[model samples]
Target: MYFNNNLKKFMKENEISLNQLANICELSINTLRELKNNPSHNTNLSSLVILAQALDCSIKDLIEDDIATINFEKVAEKNKNNRLFIRQQVFSPENVQYLRNLFLQVGVPCNISSYGRYKTASVKNEYELSSIKVDFNLRVLDLKECTILQIVDFYVSVNQLLLNEAVIKDTLIKAFETYARKLKLNQIHFIIDRDYERQDDQYSNEHSELQAYFTYTLGTESMLFVQNNYERSPFPELEEYQIEWRKTLS
Candidate 1:
């Protein structure tokens, strides 16, 4: 069963109680009790916020594992002599499992081996997701490792006249640039799969083209936080933030 025993473990380590957490999160006592007793249930976003705030951890840290898998195209090319570096979303077991599968499948030829999950000891900036816990580290591929274009998903929405596919893409590019400038992340790229539909012109202003859609990596960390705490919240900004990540890669 999906159990967030990590929550209890963390609480014990921190010497915190449910009552104390409730006060810290401004949540009702019953909510905290529910979390302590049954954390496996589907939690709402606000509830996640409450728990995360109380524990000073990421929402992923408060959850249990989700299922994931990966497919291999070919055997690994590189030998086991090289070191692997990874940066992924915090508290994302699904992604971890996917990477695990991918590494095993690809490493079949080179006899490459994978290292289990470990802590991110070299975090340059704690301000960047400092609250996150239980990050995954895999020693199978180097930062220069490149994978074929498997899939790209684009999450876009044009609620106002300003946001559109072009604008959204541009905003993402700008966000990446900001991160590259601030965090010195020089090598990063993206592949997007977009799903969009046009609404009846009568239903929206002529400028309002599309409704809403989302794109995410199957097993990778998003560029939403390229810089310190500069997250891509209210993401897919359809207006004013016009930048292209593809350009930088090119």
Candidate 2:
């Protein structure tokens, strides 16, 4: 497929120079230039995956034949239908808007809803049905409905921005601290483990920041507090976390 318009669309949308894209995707500037100049020659799966991840999009979006323009009316209609689907689920206002943003990001039209926290989605696209043979593919965890346990171990999806240890430490520590105080619980017992994989080759995956935001949203919710010692965790609070760096469905 031709890469000129598609590549340029993401480049412009992300507002990054060629050099920056090259650096982020691990493709050399010369390679990017060559591809841009010769759009039809040799664009492959690996580079496409890398580029899409760097630009925060799906591979389908990266390899589209042309940049599809967003129609306001169509978007409005889709969102209206989506809102209906969400309302049918009887979720909170924040959860309804969250679903809206999910559809808007992927630009795919879907109308299904599920109930409860940490459950399989009620709707599955064709790709999902025929793709994975695993027992589980997707899940959503609602911090608001989560029980206050002495310790919680959960996984987080990492994005391109979370590359260094310092950044990871600062990011997680701040989130834990904020939510701990807001929830009136000890920081040590909450969010004791963090395991992350890179958010590549997937659509509508939740990341660390989004998870943190979910935790923050539950700040005002009332829950029983259960305290645990730092010994319960693999490492002490505020210490470095173990994050596995690999590409998986984000």
Candidate 3:
């Protein structure tokens, strides 16, 4: 049995109520009540730490003690998909070199650099402001949906902006709009994560804000694909998002 159940047993023996335990643990009353009601519930690391401190027990003592025989399959089965992928485009050789120069100017330490036909480049830079490890990858791909001349990948977090987020976001929006209009891309497709979070339920604040996946149409087939995919999403809310207007390309 897990330590949560053991803890519950201990509490019962001590004649302590969940409300009293909540007060002692400095944990949310709802959280403590839930733990008592469902000892099998998986507590978050933060909550567990607080609870352990209140109980005068180490985390190890509160975790499952029958490690040798505990079945891992049950926990494994509960795990959900946790994949993070972000894709954006940078156009023009000037735009490409501009970013390369920007990073070069920063003089941040990086590891694992490479160059290829798509001109993929990856760098590791720890942000000075937040001291967080930020991995950056830039590349060019034959979007097949946009002109070969106008598609490049901009794969850095928006948080790395030297200026305010609003400024960077506006600049990006203008740049992407210009590229789409110039290339006559009626369809645009992008893959992005909603946000990064310590807990699945937690929001990805400024550290991880993104507009999510987008698709643009260059051809009839691509347009059809975009339409179908849009309708099939669990977040039907995205269907209401407005597409940037494209001026006729000469």
Whose lDDT is greatest here?
Answer: 3
Candidate 2 stretches greater than 4 Å from native: 1-5, 66-250
| Candidates' C-alpha lDDT | 0.37, 0.38, 0.42
lDDT of 3 by residue, 138-195 (tens): 4434454533222222223333333233333234334444554443444433333333
Better of 1 and 2 by TM-score: 1
TM-score of each: 0.26, 0.25, 0.26
- Global local distance difference test of model 2: 0.38
Worst 10 residues of 2 by lDDT: 213-222
* TM-score, candidate number 3: 0.26
lDDT, model 3, position 52: 77
Off by over 4 Å in 3: 1-5, 68-250
Model 3: how far residue 211 lies from native, Å: 76
Superposed by TM-score, candidate 2 places the C-alpha of residue 112 at a distance from the truth, in angstroms, of: 36
